[model samples]
Target: MDDPLAWLDDTAQARQAAGLRRVLAPRDVVEPLVDLASNDYLGLARDARVIEGAVVATRTWGAGSTGSRLVTGTTRLHAELEEALAAFVGTAGALVFSSGYTANLGAVTALSGRGAVVVSDVAAHASLVDAARLSRARVVVARCSAPDEVDRHLAAAPETRRLVVTDGVDSVDGGLAPLAALHAVCRARGAVLLVDDAHGLGVRGPGGAGLVAEAGLAGEPDVVTTATLSKSLGSQGGVVLGSAAVIAHLVDAARAFIFDTGLAPGSVGAALTALGVLRDEPERVAALHRAAAAVAASARSAAPELGVADPTAAMVPVVLGEPDLAVAARDACAAAGLRAGCFRPPSVPEGTSRLRLTARADLSADDLALVDRVLGEVLPAVLGRTGVSAG
Candidate 1:
């Protein structure tokens, strides 16, 4: 008989031919390179206090949550985290989920149904896109940077209930969404606005509350926010912040939350400690922006035509517009003792593959100087092959 999975080989060959074959290249425990690829913006992933918190939680609550949250997983730490997050973000309540993806799923699906319409940002993360698909609602796409177009979509929808969803920060290109303007449009159209501020938490807004709060939209009746603890907080899990009614509804209606196991106890503890650290050291947020700007400036210096945007968060994307050129540039950086993110198709639009460099608040001046020197060498060589002139 023919192999049942023989089609997989054909698909793999197709991917290989297109320069889209991916390899799982795990790093060594002690990589002696300047890191610009990780999402640990605050450098708290391995902080002494954060580690101690994890240890204490593990000792107190064991390794796993043991059950779904509704059954037996709602530990005191979870409750405390929920309350603290709501308070921090200026929301009436908060609900925690196992991951940011799940949080987005829960928030979108619970808030939208057959009669409701969902307007999603074109450049949003996959989580939001999948959430809109799973919502079983009519989905429309609009440019998140263009609030007027979103408003037009909402105005045209016949559904009485409408939802507008977008990222607080564009994950791939690191562009800040127009949160305030989007909220205004949603308000005018009698629609609800959901902002997934996964990249904004612990990196933007007052005391690192997030971009929703920074835009002065926090606690607004029609606005909801979702965020993750894995990035700037240097932990794991996700949370949804909104009115008390929304939180209660999600608890009852969100399948992702009701069916999935709760977030691990250690992650909850580590996140709590990280929150405390962020509260005490808000200046870390400023340091993070400085590092990102420095990286962007360096990348731009090498290929001025790359048009690297000034980042408001901890990410700087160097768009090379070709998958092989981007991969080559990333490898060249690795050879120069630097680790940069290689983003390609699906993560970004076709022909816009690039390097996504993240910044850490603790990156030293010497570290930045190294980035400047390395990008100055790596980007020009790669851009040359792409025929992108080095202005």
Candidate 2:
């Protein structure tokens, strides 16, 4: 009784010492700051059409989903969203989930089991790793961002039913997976390829369909894709898209799909509207890519010593070697009225903490200029004593 909670105190102290003390600061929606951290790639979160759709759907269907989809949760709105999403992404069918993380978990665990082997990229999102852990699958972590490693892993485990899982776009580094090659490897190994296109949808591919489509792997018989509505759709849910039979299996087998609360009508409506908007304005995707490239270019020009991976989508990471420096750089940006995302250990496999800057279609050139100025000032201080120069 004297020191029952002593371990908690020590853990907190250790985290604090390493500059990893996380905090929750609720932000004011209308704060005067340049935002470069949000996942709203298409900037439809506040669009009148998107907001109005949510409002109408909420007024018509109520606030919450009220029950699981198997109960009273499968609204007509959800059906419409599923249909639209499937068609948009070039898949035979789609099933919406509460969140992207849950979608990944549901898809992976349902598709893989004890006798199965999941050849996952070393740098996949935490959700996929968690899904693999829960599946009791023989999880093999291949090389970071290398499809060849996936092939090798599959080759080494020829007897197991295998699934090659990866993020279409690396959330931290903004690098794209070699999805076409990965799919080829999967095909050669008779494995299934599951791509989590959370950061790819509404930012890449034809009319922002996704990276799987961009790589010409969409609708492939052995390929499955998962995406989040929260990112570019400006909504709050996730979807798994694949062949009709695969989706049907998920409906019957996935616990998350069967037991979890369905996506609310409002989110379903918003996502549907966002998809329409994306179709009507394909240029938005192009703008997002351009903005991301511009930001990456600026970072490279201003701080060449900083490892700024070339962005294939809206995500851009400015690599800071240490967690303490990353936090300091992020704070410096915040102080200068710029909001940026910070990524550290566990989230990044490289063990190099970074400032993750995400570009939105709504971010003007002026906003990017502010990002440049803030980083120019903060990066130097963060990289102290090295006296680094831009390449």
The lDDT leader among the candidates is 1
> What tens-digit string does per-residue lDDT give for candidate 1 at 130-154?
9999999999999969999998999
What lDDT tens digits, residue by residue, belong to model 2 across residues 247-271?
A: 9999988998899999889998899
Candidate 2 has an lDDT of: 0.88
Model 2 error, position 102 (Å): 0.7
Cα displacement (Å) at residue 123, model 2: 0.7
Q: How do all models score by TM-score?
A: 0.98, 0.96
How does model 2 score by TM-score?
0.96
Stretches of candidate 2 exceeding 4 Å from the true structure: 158-160, 307-309, 385-391
Give lDDT: candidate 1, residue 35: 94
How far is 325's C-alpha from truth in model 2 (Å)? 0.9
Clashes within 3 Å, all models in order: 0, 0
Summed over model 2, clashes come to 0
Relative to the unseen true structure, what is the C-alpha lDDT of residue 173 in candidate 2, on a scale of 0 to 100? 71
